[model samples]
Target: MGDLVLHLDNINKSFGGLSALSDVNLHVEEGTTHAIIGPNGAGKSTLLNVCIGRLKPDTGKVTFAGEVLTGRQPHEIAQLGVARVFQTPEIFQEMTLLENVMIPALSHRDGAFRLNATELLSKQGEVREEAEHILEDVGLKDMMMVEAASLSRGDKRRLELGMCLILRPRLLLLDEPTAGMARHDTNQTIELLKKIKSRGMTKVIIEHDMHVVFSLADKVSVLARGQIIAGGDPQSVREDPKVKEAYLGGTT
Candidate 1:
């Protein structure tokens, strides 16, 4: 196994009197794809929020790359090479797909939000080239100049994925990346993810698609009612009785 890139120890979170996550523990190995699955309201998203610093756990710790991550802001976590893709695609509606990807690269090179107009335009070629490379990687090259809002749903998802990829994050967290897509689109997204994985990215994904999980995950963790019920290789997780009863609805 690779070194641990992310560690969540005894994590717990609650909103008022409602418990969203309780004593949840997980470890993601470097360069491996780890999938977390659960039923609705199972706190899967909550766990992801905590991982990427969007939400803080009332108890327990989050560590990334041997550095303590508790209490860090989302951007701070992101700067530390963690990137998250939300369930809903959040692209700049007015910007071209190339523009969207260039934003991050420009920010990385010129400091966030501080680029002068002249300098920004001067850097545009480099940014566009880099963005186009990422778009190509995500299968979006032909749509580079298209307004993000004008793309089809799958293409928009691809654009969002491209945005995340440009960051070159050490760990990528995705929540329902294939959510709301048609079967063909979902499979395309799956192939894109597989291509990413083959390039040696470490990913932690929260997904409900068993096919995607089984095909891509090196390990699987099944959650129910705020705790992990079973965790192991994908095949074992698929066959795990407790997981079948609690989250998989006895599908196994």
Candidate 2:
């Protein structure tokens, strides 16, 4: 076990007449993968949005590394080392894969698209090297020069992962990183995530793929109707009666 890197206490959120999340409580330990699994409309993504400061909770608190994060803006949270990868892969359509990966690294060095030509040129070598290294780490080294929009769905996801990796975030929030991939690609994605966890990065993932969740998560939280009903080790959660009844539909 390690220090609690992310903590959510009694978090609640609503959209007019609908409650998206209610009394959600979660803690992710440093260097572990914690999975959030639930059926459709379970408020899983909404919870993530709140955690990363894309949405403010009506009540409760979000803390990261001892700092209160309830009302901070998304970019502000990113500056504090919280990175989010959305469900849809967000890549620069016209940019080369290498260039796409370099953007975040450059931002880290020169501050988010604020660089003048001289500053940009001075940091080019280090930023490209770092980006290329991340690409290699994510199995996209050979595709460095390809236009991002031309990538296959799986590779697009890899490129997105590389972008997040370049940030070296303390808390990584992934929304369905494996969605819509072929079986082989899904396994590859899982392997990539495992490699990331091995490097001691903390991850909190929202996923519907049970196989991936069971294989990679050290702990699992079952969310249904905007609340967590079970939280524990993967095997224990897989065996929980309430979890089976609620999300698993009586299947283990």
Candidate 3:
């Protein structure tokens, strides 16, 4: 097997008496796209939250790059090279796209969100150059000077991705990336993700779109009732009986 990058062992979580995760275990190989799929309330987001340090699991451990991350803070985990793209776009609607991208790029370089006005202005050109290059890569170079609020849904998602890429993260976790996208936009995202995969950035995606799942995932895991019922390569997992039942007789 490839060198493991992220591992979850016996992860469990709950609210009151409702179980969100139960003995959930997952292994993500380095430089691979691992997709996690489940119906609503199947604990997919909870598992991701645990992995990214947004929620501390009631029990179990999360390890990344050989270091235990179970108790680390979200920023601490990010410092360890993890980035997440939420279901909706996360950007500064009032700011220019270039400004939105440059903020994180600047933070990545300066080690935090503190920079004097003079120093910021002095470094603006360099940071702007880097942010522009990333925007180009994400196919948003033309929108650099435009207000973020004016971009289309797909473009907004692209901008959010650009923000994450500014960190040069080793692992990217995406939750429902194409949820509200049209077919054309979804296809565009697929092509963009294809490029990202070619660059060897490991990704763990939680999505309902089988087309998107099969398009990018190197391995697939299906979650149901807060547990993984089937997992393997795309073809095999797609044909698994338990997965079919979990998708309500294979409708999903």
Q: Which lDDT values do the candidates have, in the order given?
A: 0.86, 0.89, 0.88
Please give each candidate's TM-score.
Answer: 0.94, 0.95, 0.95
Please give, for residues 1-252, the per-residue lDDT of candidate 1 as tens digits.
588879999999999989999999899999999999999889999998888888889999999998888998777787888888888887898998878998877765665456385554654787778878998898888877888898887787778888888988888889899888899989989988988887677899999889889888999998899999999999998788888888777443
TM-score of predicted structure 2: 0.95
| Clashes by residue pair, model 2 | none
Between prediction 1 and prediction 3, which has the larger lDDT?
3
Ranking by TM-score: 2, 3, 1
Compute the lDDT of residue 219 as modeled in candidate 2. 88
Q: Write the per-residue lDDT of candidate 2 for residues 129-222, one digit (tens) a residue.
A: 9998999998989989999999998889889989998998888899999999999999999988888887788899999889999899998999
* Tens-digit per-residue lDDT, 1-252, candidate 3: 399989999999998989999999999999999999988889998988998899999999999999898999888788788888988887899999999998888778776456466664545788889999999988999879899999998889989998998988888999888888999989988888888887677899999999899998999999998898989999999888888878836555
**Model 1, C-alpha of 147: deviation from truth (Å):** 1.5
Instruction: Name the TM-score of candidate 3.
Output: 0.95
RMSD of each: 1.7, 1.6, 1.6
**lDDT for 158 (candidate 1):** 78
